[model samples]
Every structure is written in C-alpha cells, then in structure tokens.
Target chain A: AQTVTQSQPEMSVQEAETVTLSCTYDTSESDYYLFWYKQPPSRQMILVIRQEAYKQQNATENRFSVNFQKAAKSFSLKISDSQLGDAAMYFCAYRSRGNDMRFGAGTRLTVKP
Target chain B: DAMVIQNPRYQVTQFGKPVTLSCSQTLNHNVMYWYQQKSSQAPKLLFHYYDKDFNNEADTPDNFQSRRPNTSFCFLDIRSPGLGDAAMYLCATRAGPQETQYFGPGTRLLVL
Candidate 1:
C-alpha cells in the first residue's frame, strides 16, 4: 500500500517570516509525482506546486517551493515570506504510474500578523 | 473559467435515501475521479473513470458506485447513504494518470 505522511499537524509563522512543512512517502515505484495542494477555509483545493520523481531539481511556484530528496523519500514544502493568505490546510500528495492519488495527514498553517 | 463543475453544491438527504452527485468537465480529460473528504481530513478516493473504463479502489465501500455515460460527464451514486457518508464530495479531472489534476468546487453532502 502507498502512504504519505506529514509530520507536523499544525505550524505557525509570523508574517514576512518563512515556514516549512514536512512530508515523506513510501513507494516502491521509481516513477511518480508529488504535489502540494492548499485548501483554504471553506474553499476548494488548489495546486501550489508539483515535483516529478525523476527530476533532480526541486519545484518552485513563486513563493511556494519544495525541497525534494528522492533518495530519502522526503518532499518538504517551504513558504517564503509567509502571507496571511497562505494560512490554510496544506496537503502533500503522491501519485504513482497508477491512477490512485494518496494524501498525507495535512498540516494546518497559521499566519500571524 | 473553471473547467470542472459539480452541481448542487450542498445536498441534504435522509438516512437510507439514495443520492447522486453529478460532475462534468470541459477539459476533455480521460480520467475523472471522485473523492470523499470529511471534516479536517484528507480526501479519500472512491472511484475513478478512465474514459469508458471504470476503476474502483480496493477498499472503496460497496455502496458507492460511479458511472460515465460520456467522455465529459460522471456520476456518483450512494445506494443507501448513512451518517458516515456525510462529507464533501470532490470531483477532479486529469488528462491521464500522469497529468496534474484539476478539481471542481465540491458538493457537501449532509445525511440526516
């Protein structure tokens, strides 16, 4: 079975500061994809960034970026200059060559003014 | 414009009543997936349709069923909705298994 884990259940960061959310997955397959999705209060989920397993370079989407270490099966998301809008539930997901997409226990990010 | 759409954003159904949620996509994606998300939890995959083919998750409840009559439309039917079935049902579409998924505003199901 494929599983994704988010170690931090909740994280807090002050405005203009930076915070990182940790994620790791267990997969035997060599080719797959990783994604970070954000779900704001009462809103639909949106993609933040995506990282392919074969790429050695990490993925970045503006202020949102990921430090992906495939050898260790670690994919952590970093939010630089955290904004109030960034406060939401961040979910780390894994998708294999198969169609099934699995999500981790999401990390709730709180931004302080 | 949002490519994916789910109708009746909020639905209330009585216990033991059968309910169906509809999803349509204009993206012409080959794979459409239905996910169930409870309060403060991850979205769980119920089933997905790859074009005309239907794929079910091994642990998906037997009561949950899906249909894809055409390339752009999909439906999820709950044979007998229980209290545990109350959750936000999300519809997503992607070109294929290897593509990024685009999601629609989910339908929140309420079981009474």
Candidate 2:
C-alpha cells in the first residue's frame, strides 16, 4: 500500500521569510506524481504545485517549489517570501498512474508578521 | 470557471439521522472523489466515480452509499449518522490520469 507522510504537524515562518515542509512517500512504482496542496480557513483545497517522478528537475510555481528526491522518496515543499496569506494547512499528496491520490497527515503553516 | 461545488457548506444532523451531501462539477472531469477529513488529519478516501461506474472503498461503512446519476453530479448518503461520522466532506474532480485536480470548498458535517 502506498502511504504519504508529512512529519511536521505544524510549522511557522516570519513574513517574507522562507519555510520548508517535509514529505515522504513509500511506493514501489517508478511512474508516479507528487503534489502540494494548501487548505485555508475556508477549507478549500488548492493545488500549489506538482512534480512528476520521471522528471529529474524539480517543479516550481511562483513562490512555491518542491525538492523531489526519488531515491530518498522525499518531496519537500519550499515556500519562499512567505506572506501572511500563506498561513494554512499544507498537505502533501501522492498519486500513481490509474490510482487514487493519497494524502499525508498535513502540516499547519503559520506565517507570522 | 470550471469548479466543484458542494452544497450546504455546513451541516448539523442528529445521531442516527439520515443525511445526504451533494457535489456538482462543471469541469466535466472523468473522475469524482469523496473524502472524509477529520480535524487535523489527512482526508480519507471514501469512494469515487469513473463516469457512471460507482467505486466504493473496501473499508467504507455499509451505512454510507453513493450515487452518481450523471456526469456532473454525485451524491453521498449517510443512512445512520454517528458522532464519528462528523467531519469535513470534500468533493474533488480530476481529469483522468492526473491531468488536473480540484476540490470543492468542502462541507463540514456536525453530528449531535
């Protein structure tokens, strides 16, 4: 069974600073995908970024980027220039071809001004 | 905007009462998923629909049922609500093969 793990239950970052949330997954499949999702107080889950396992290059979207290490099974999210609006619950997810997505326990990010 | 819509953003039901949560999508995605998210925890997949084919998770309680009459709408039925069933019900739509994934704002269910 594939499982995603987010070790950090809560994290904090000063506004304009940077923060990284760690994630790891256990999977035997080489062809897969990883994702970072942000859920604000509205409870709306928004896709932050995505990374394909075959791609050696990490995926970056605006101020969010991922350090995807296939060998170590690590997919960590880096939020640069964090803003107050970045305070939310961040969830790391994994999905393989023709399979449903699995989510981690989630990490609550607090962007302090 | 192509989006997923979940009705009754907040719901309060008595224990043993029957409750239904509805989800509609304008994305025309091939798959629709329902997940239960307890406080501070990951969302657990309850079931999903591929086109009109209903797929329920093996661990899903028999008291929970799902109906997808068409492509744009799906309904989750809880025959007997329990306190443990109280959680945020999230509806997500995806273009098959992980092309795109979007989640509804989510409905918070409160069982009394």
**Predicted structure with the largest DockQ when compared to the true one:** 2
Q: How close is candidate 2 to the true structure, as a TM-score?
A: 0.97
Fnat per candidate: 0.76, 0.92
Task: Judge candidate 2 at residue A6 and give its lDDT.
Answer: 92
Please give the lDDT score at residue A57 for candidate 1.
95
Deviating ranges (above 4 Å) for candidate 2 = none
Task: Residues B1-112, candidate 2: write the lDDT tens digits.
Answer: 6489999899999999999999999988989999998888888999999898888899999999999998999999999999999999999999889575799999999999
Q: Lowest summed-lDDT stretch of 10 residues in model 2 chain A?
A: A35-44
Against the native chain B, what TM-score does each candidate's chain B reach? 0.97, 0.96
lDDT of 2 by residue, A12-96 (tens): 9999999999999999999999999999876699999999999999999999999999999999999999999999999999999
